[model samples]
Target: MFWFQEGLCCLPTFLVVWSSSTFIVNYLIALFRRDVDVVFPYISDTGASPPESCIFGLMSTITAFAGFATMFARYKYLQRLNEITGGVSPALNKAALFFAITSCVGMCFVATFQETAIRIVHDIGAFIFFLSGVVYIILQTIISHKAHPYGTSKRVCYIRTIFAVVAFLAAFPTIICAFFVKETRLHWNPEDKEYTPHLASAVSEWIVSFTFVFFFFTYIQEFKQFTLKVNTELLEFK
Candidate 1:
């Protein structure tokens, strides 16, 4: 039974982990491109140092592709879940769709554009993802409390609610920090004119990073709760 339960959850977790890993790898590769100096001579002055050409660009491209694949997987997963559950809430479904679209767009843009633009869009995408995650968890909590046959105790419901709230609150500071961080720049002309979309990109990255960390911890707790519930159900059956 544990095997069956894990099999059911494994695909989604794998998709998320793979997508995230690709993204990080790509970001690291872009950080060290040799042509970075030629493209943005003034990068040093702005506190953005050029990195050695590495696998980041390739990784980033791979990440983009993986993200798109994950989006499709997520859609299919939700669709099947809806069928099993008699239908998901329209609002939650819509929100999930929004996040899926935004994240895909952001990843595509990051692959095609310069770092600054990519940073800005990525931040927006991250926020959408964070928002969607929160909504899904909340809606699930509500459904579990109201409908689950095992009967959710009031204490359990309250604890879940508090955890969700704390997770949501962490997003704000993360976003704010991302907005204020420095950005990578590229010079267009020989006049050494600087054009870096620093403020937004920096802040976005900071916020996304912080938010991801917070969500990671929150999700671990959520997973524990889910496992506990499943175990209890299985024991009762035994």
Candidate 2:
């Protein structure tokens, strides 16, 4: 059972652990180096400087690749399930896959372009990641509902719907409040006028990131029931 899809959980688990660890490590490093505020810094803020930035870039790149694998596996799994169930929404599945892939590409951009280096490009990447990621989960929730109690369970569908809703709730504020802050300061003071908006946006970003990790965690159980297979055919040359 080498191809037993239960092992697919490792990809998401790796993503969750690796990304979370990357955040925590960078946060501590930036805090200790006095490179960022003690209160709360944007994840990118923690990775803006030298030593920590190196770690952040390397880890985030790997995280992005892992994300790609996880999404592709899920896409193939659903496609196979739909075939077996005679489902009518292949287009929906394809749409979900597209958004997921696009989000991963955004993650690469986030990793490559530091906010301090090219602020606009970095922000564009973050925007794409958050927006596409939220849409992907929402679409997946819809797909789960469409699958019903046959291909998937009511409980799983409800859980995914909740995660999707939470992600949307968080992502909106993360993007909106970010625009209100006029300056990007590594060390933020509580009394600063932009502090409130900055805090709101940073907190929202963390919430969205953690929600994405948990949402991927939910895929573990569902993945256990299936298997992935690749077939090769040799053709005669004329």
Candidate 3:
């Protein structure tokens, strides 16, 4: 019980580090194997092939669940605060939870369905994941700013708001630049017409991914300031 309470504060850090490493390590693997070029590639592109694909799938599955747990923890924390202060309605927190869960579901799809193998499913998943994730963070920022004395400092809210803005800004270009690319490939020549657009899209995606990590990183200290308890009662019949 002591360990559980103590370790709960590290949930945000674990999510940030694990997910960031998942992307970086996969990129390095793909590069080392010559499966992908040194140039920026879509996050999915790095994990679309053999060994890296296997690692990507497994690690990404874990990342998705970790992300969901972090979000759910935040939701529950906010709900408890609302119960005490009555600052925001339960519905707002529920909406944030809904989007966070939806984003994780999308992440699961991205993990299970490799982009090179199932482009349509992968694309759909990417769409859902980024779109829902942006909404989740935006809602979270609002709640953080509005929730009174929830141990959320103004600086934390500002940091979240900045990352939320970056995610929103990067999301549009990730989709728009992809439209400009004629084809999707792991390696691209500088001379190819699709190269620039693909690079733009890829870079934008990396920015958005980093923004998520940064936003979650902000939660670490705030989470440490509070403790949560779960109670379960079993019914007994005589």
Instruction: List the candidates ranked by lDDT, beginning with the highest.
Output: 3, 2, 1
lDDT digits (tens) for residues 85-108 of candidate 3:
888779999999999999999999
lDDT of 1 by residue, 72-139 (tens): 44444445445666445545655655655555555444444444434565456455555554554455
lDDT of each: 0.44, 0.87, 0.89
Which stretches of model 3 miss by more than 4 angstroms?
Answer: 1-7, 235-238
- Models 1 onward score TM values of 0.46, 0.92, 0.93
The better-scoring model by TM-score among 2 and 3 is 3
Clashing pairs in 3: none
lDDT top scorer: 3
**lDDT for 46 (candidate 1):** 22
Error of 3 at 78 (Å): 0.3
- On lDDT, the stronger of 1 and 2 is 2
What is the per-residue lDDT of model 2 for residues 104-189, given as tens digits with 9 covering 90 to 100? 88988998999999988999999999999999999989988888866568998899999999999999889999999878678778
Candidate 1 clash figure, as a count:
14
Quote the lDDT for 15 in model 2: 78
Instruction: Give me the runs in candidate 1 sitting further than 4 Å from their true place.
Output: 1-17, 23-54, 116-167, 181-238
